[model samples]
Target: MTDRNRRFLLKARPNGMPKTSDFALVEEALPDLQPGQFLIRNHYASLDPAIRGWLDDAPSYMPPVALGDPVRASTVGVVAESKAEGFKAGDWVMGLNAIEEYSMAQAGGFSQLIDIGNVSSPTHFLSVMGAVGLTAYFGVTEILKPEAGQTMLVSGAAGAVGSLVGQLGKQAGCRVIGIAGGPAKCARLTDDYGFDAAIDYRGKSAEALSDEIGAAAPKGIDLVFENVGGIGLDATLLHLNRFARVALCGLISEYNSEHYGARNLWQLIVHSATVRGFLISEFLDRFAEGAAAMAKLVGEGRLRFDEHIEEGIDNALPAFLRLFEGSNQGKMILKLI
Candidate 1:
């Protein structure tokens, strides 16, 4: 373990897409571990869009990252120092840590030990079997429960959670339609991920996208696993069938937008459809159950997910910006080691 730590701190709250000026890189001495505290040498930091929301000094599920504090993120690492029982040096763990070379965590907190024997890769804990997996699982099975023969729409269908959600919808016997940005991703949605149909939402207005959605779901949308909101969601809302269920997961499109223009909310009232905002944290107690189910599927080769890993801590800001730029190939991860 190094005597010092490198951190990507929030220097300023961004007005739109974050830039280098919004952050500051600093090196600081690692402090002595106190009783009940354990130090982890982070191997990889998960770069999720949710972290973007945390940068704003607005109301959210978690507090915004304080200026000069290391940006909050989920990281997988090996314990390097432990003053706590049930944790030891070399033990692999994952937790809501920070974008840094090392993070200090406490026992009985959000951090949990990982069974490397069962995991295909430690990074999988940050992808298919971790928060992303749980988000797709509970967001589908628990929240937007789909019935056989129903039509399900997944926005950001090529994303980490969206990809898994599409496959699960298929397994549940719903005809799944995916909305991605490009022809390449749209093609993979059907060819690789088994989505019944794929809609490319790029370079299209809300009306144009809605027309495509109508053609894709001629029977009307019975369920929506929405990730990218704004026009994408507004378009989807226009096709909601009576009593439709929408698992409102994210609004990535509006994250960097100064003007939030979602104009089709009246569709909800028109169709009596339900939209429930989903946060995986709500199902924290059942995370193990969700992880086991997803792991089994991955083990049997029934699940397919992707990871777009960018190497080095120095590239953290650029790597994170790829998420909003729609350039990441899969789950965004920063490999520090």
Candidate 2:
């Protein structure tokens, strides 16, 4: 427990998109485990868009990642030492820890023991079987509630949560349409994930994108799973069916920048629609329920997802930037060991 740890700390609140200079990788001695605390040697960290929002000094669901502190992230690590009541050394666990070589936390809350018997890989705790998968599961089943013969539209459809949302929408027998950038991702939406149709939003204006959505879904969108907001959301708003339901998840496009325009917020009034903004944390008690259902589908090969893993604490900044750049191949993970 006397090992020196390398931690990625927030050096400054980012202005617009983050840069390497916004974070600092510093070495420090691991503190002795105090009473009611446990320490783990982190093996992997989930690189998610929500983590980016924490870098700003703004009020949110949680406090922002304070300057000169380890940047907060969901990490899977092994218990190297424990002074806490429920945890013991040599145990595998995952939780909202930080991006570092070693993380110290108290017992309970989000940090819980991992059943290695059910885990296929440590990274799966950060990907398909983890928060990413659970986010898609609860958002679709509980919030959006896609119905048979209905049309469901998912923005950021090529990425982790969005892709899974589209697939789950299909399981509900909804006609799923995905909005992604580029032809390759659009093709993958239909070819790989079984989306009924895909729209490429790269070169299109709001009107153009809305027209494409209308064509793909002439009946109008009954359920909208929104991830990337702004233009795509505005476009989708214009195409809502009467009394459509919209699940507002993470707005990745507005995280790094201060500029975000809806232009069509009034459409909800016009269409008698319902838009619910939710956090996955809201379903904390039902995690076991969602996990079991998603696990069954995954085990049967009915659910598919990919992880874009980048190794080393030294690569944390670049790996995170991949999410904003849309260059990441799958659910983003940082491998520290």
Candidate 3:
């Protein structure tokens, strides 16, 4: 192991999309491990849209990453040394680590050893077997509760969570329609991820997209798994069946913007539909159950996922920015090790 640890510290809060200047890379000596503490050599770090919310000094799910501190992220790594019970050197683990080369974690903190024995890659622990899958699983299975023969619509269907949401909806016997950004992603949604139909939203106006959604789900949408909020949610809201349900997930389209309004929200009243927003942390007690179910589906070849890995810690900032730009195909991961 190297004597130095490399990390990215927040230098300033971003005004819009984060720039590389907002962070500073620094190398410091690895601190001595204390009792009840373990040192992790981070291999991969997850790049998520939620990280943008954390950059601002605002009230939300968790506290903002304090200025001058390493940016917080979910990471998979190996224990390089340990002084904690239930952990040992060489054990693989995942936790709310940081965008750093090494991290010090406590025994009963967010850090937990992960069993990657049945998976082909360690990155799966950060994708299908991690919080990404857990969010999709609980959001779809528990929140939406889509029934067989119902028509379900998923926005951002080509993304990591949306991709899984679409597949889980299919497994529940729903006729799934996916709305993605471009033709390639739209094609992958139907051909690769098992969506019944896919709508490309690239060059369409709001009315045009709404018409496309209507064409795709002529029977009207029974369930809407909304990930991209702005135009997509507005479009999906126009065709909700009576007593329809909406699992409001991430609103990526409006994440970096100041104005966010949905024009068709009145449809909820007209259709007597329910729309609920959730955070994965709220289902912490049942995470194991969700993870197990997702793993089973993946192991059985019933669920699918993809990862867009950016090599090395130096590329972390660029990889993160790609999420907002819609350049990432699936889960965006920084391969540090």
Task: Give a tens-digit lDDT track for model 1, residues 189-266.
Answer: 999999999999999998999999999999899999989988889899999999999998998998898646678888
Per-model TM-score on C-alpha atoms: 0.98, 0.98, 0.98
Candidate 1 — which pairs collide?
Answer: none
Q: For residues 1-337, what per-residue lDDT tens digits would candidate 3 score against the true structure?
A: 8889999899999888788889999999999989999999999999888888899998998999999999999999999999999999999999998999999999879998998788899999889989999999999888999899999999989999999999999999999999998789998998899999999988787899999999999999999888888877888899999999999888888777774799989999999999999999989889789889988998898998999999998888888988987889889999998
> Runs in model 2 with CA error above 4 Å?
none
User: How do the residues 236-261 of candidate 2 rate in per-residue lDDT, one tens digit apiece?
Assistant: 99999999999999789898877587
Candidate 2: TM-score? 0.98
RMSD of each: 0.9, 1.0, 1.1
Best by lDDT: 1
Top candidate (TM-score): 1
What is the alpha-carbon lDDT of model 2 when measured against the actual structure?
Answer: 0.91
Count clashing residue pairs in model 3.
Answer: 0
Ranking by lDDT: 1, 3, 2
CA lDDT, candidate 2, residue 80: 93
Model 1 spans > 4 angstroms off: none
What TM-score number comes out for model 1? Answer: 0.98
Model 3 / residue 263 / CA error / Å: 2.2
